[model samples]
Target: MAYDNTPSFDHLPIPLTSDLVKTEHGQVVFTAVNGAGGLETKVVDLVDGAPGAFAPRTPDVRTVIDRDSFGRELRRRGLDSDGTVWASRAKGRVTAVYNDLSTDLDDAYTRRDDRLMLQFVTDPDWSTFGNVADGQYHGQEEFGDLLDDAGHLIISHQAADLVELADSIRATSSGHFESRIQRSTGSQSVGWSESVEARAGAAGDLEVPKVVVFRVARFEDFPTVDLVCQVRLRVKGGQLLLGLFPRPYEHLLREQWQTVIGELGAEIGRDIYATA
Candidate 1:
């Protein structure tokens, strides 16, 4: 079977020891593991009768692991990553996870994280973005060649506090532009999972610095992204509008998509990654 470690929206009971626990390295039998699992189990005396009580034993090496959590809502409140590998499971170097999920996903599998993001060779292709009625400064990149229904989901801030939005996707940090996945139905969709956003800021308010990479992916092989367009800022209904547009990569992205379908859902062999 495919090594499917991707997070799901299904409801599950409190996992017990011996139960298969999903990790990046495939399913492993669950153990007391850590405080999150054991604490709840030990205090409440969980049903599975998980082993014995805690004791001081040989010092075992432990690394950070991200436990999956589920949410119930239409438009999600934050970023969601879909990957098979968790580098932090083995590498004990990380202390905190305040960074973006894309970087973490990229870092887990390979060192060539830079290869995932695409560089825009041309200037802003704003030929399509022109004047609109009612003084609405609205425009959008041509997403015909790019994936449809999953392209250009608009993020409208309640106020004009997003004036610095474009500044967040500078060349130094572009992958994060649409770094956050907006919405996913958990079926029949590849990368470009419904208009990613760059709202991965450090503070709870999400002031700045959320996502930078341009993301695109294919069907098989390690999940990856290819290209991303620049962030376009405009105003509609007194709310600041933000979106990532597909400028030059439309044809290339489509070609990669077509190639993947042609090869029976094989890996996309192109250099499409999060745009940085």
Candidate 2:
């Protein structure tokens, strides 16, 4: 059976190369029907300029996505007013609502069960940091404070490599570790074995962790999340700068970034394009 071959706004792995798109059959001329009108129109407006040309139909958010405010998100981004759109946070989720064309897709990119997490990720105070002496800052210290809620947060090595590195700092090395909920896992595959404890230790040493995986209890329960994070730090001018960068799961996020551009080209649904 044939289909519309519609592509999402941030669906493509790599954006269109001009009006041409690569497909399984072969490359074909590309075109977009987007929320901002079309590819050509969006580009023209971007270059030459066309402000407020496409005022959102429900700019005031009068049209609620649903009545259950305590459950699913009722808000949306006005620019994503396509027949359907997918939005997620930490890149692990993919959800879409097949609107009947009347309901505007106006929710923010990601809606969370924990509202504070949404604000913390999207809007953070980056200026409150002060210089910490050498020993003052420890393993993921600065970033750990972001989740001060007791019993609702836990972080651990996300990968085999990081696990091995963590093992290097301990008195003994275990081939496997458990998740936050006391669930045990199988042995991990890493370049360094349980012997890493002796190899990396030398006269009492400590090392800060770089890339790690963190999980938050949704609504103060469950621990299925596996969000990746990396410590962002730089030192210069006698000052130390530090920050945290959140990322989605490896397979989940990296793969979804690729959007399908086929014979029908793509239906942008809405045109404020961006990287997933």
Candidate 3:
């Protein structure tokens, strides 16, 4: 039987492309989408953008198409209002596509339902322990001091890389927060194998902004390098989706994220966005 609403991924406007970076590894492309009010912009890294390579992988296109399709379907089923889908449900699709447009259509469902993401990456050199230092800074900090620096804290492994990273965060925040260790399961695969949750105050206050500090593991075999520490502030109950394209997610996060960035910069003694 043929269904009237099989969904179409057509009629979407193509974004004009601008080459941003080209290296032996790959190229990063920037694009702007013309909309009714203004233009929406985003950046995509083309892993296979070298000459004679196949069509570039454009997850942003799939992202836009799936959003339109999902919204249309929701409106047709009379469930277009807010909160019809929980953030937890929307964030379940945790796959990242690097350079495979062949899978884009297959992954369209996941892209359609994805929760908007905001991320902050301090320079790998932000701390000696970060990826920029050739991994020489591991286990350099006093382990016991980290655990005792704040209350309600525990150290899963004295040698865990996150400890040093967490210490940098605590020092940057002026010791106002404590750290609790948590691990990512088969789900929530934002790439943090081990993470430290930072809470406010020694006893840990629930009302303050929640921060998760973790290291995004690097694939040594991959052409790209990604040995960096990340700080993710929980959005929690607010609208997770920021509709502004081209604008940095850090800005979309507004004051809350910026406050943490400033604190980190002060602690590490470098402007986080100066190189960007």
| Runs of candidate 3 exceeding 4 Å displacement | 1-10, 48-276
* Candidate 1 ranges beyond 4 A from true positions: 1-211, 220-223, 235-239, 257-276
How would you encode candidate 1's per-residue C-alpha lDDT over 1-276 as one tens digit per residue?
A: 789889984454444444545443233454442344343342332323443443222223233222111111101322234221111112211121112345454464432221111112211212122111112223222221121222232232312323333232221121212333233332111111122367543321123322223333322231334443444343333223344444465476456534433342122211212211
Q: Tell me the spans in candidate 2 whose CA falls farther than 4 Å from its real position.
A: 1-144, 147-151, 157-206, 216-224, 248-276
Candidate 3 lDDT by residue in tens digits, 1-276: 986988874557566656577643457788787655567787776665354573433323223122234344334433221212211112211111223223345533322332322122233322322222232221213322432332222222244544454454334332222233233531121111122466432432212112222222111111222222222223222211101011122232234334544553353333334211
Estimate the overall C-alpha local distance difference test score of candidate 3.
0.32
The C-alpha RMSD in Å for every predicted model, in order, reads 27.1, 23.3, 26.9
Q: What ordering of candidates by lDDT runs from best to worst?
A: 2, 3, 1
TM-score of each: 0.19, 0.24, 0.14
Residue-level lDDT of model 2, residues 234-261, one tens digit each, is 4333223334465545464334333321
Error of 1 at 134 (Å): 21
For candidate 1, the lDDT comes to 0.29
Q: Find the 10 residues in a row with the least total lDDT in model 3.
A: 238-247
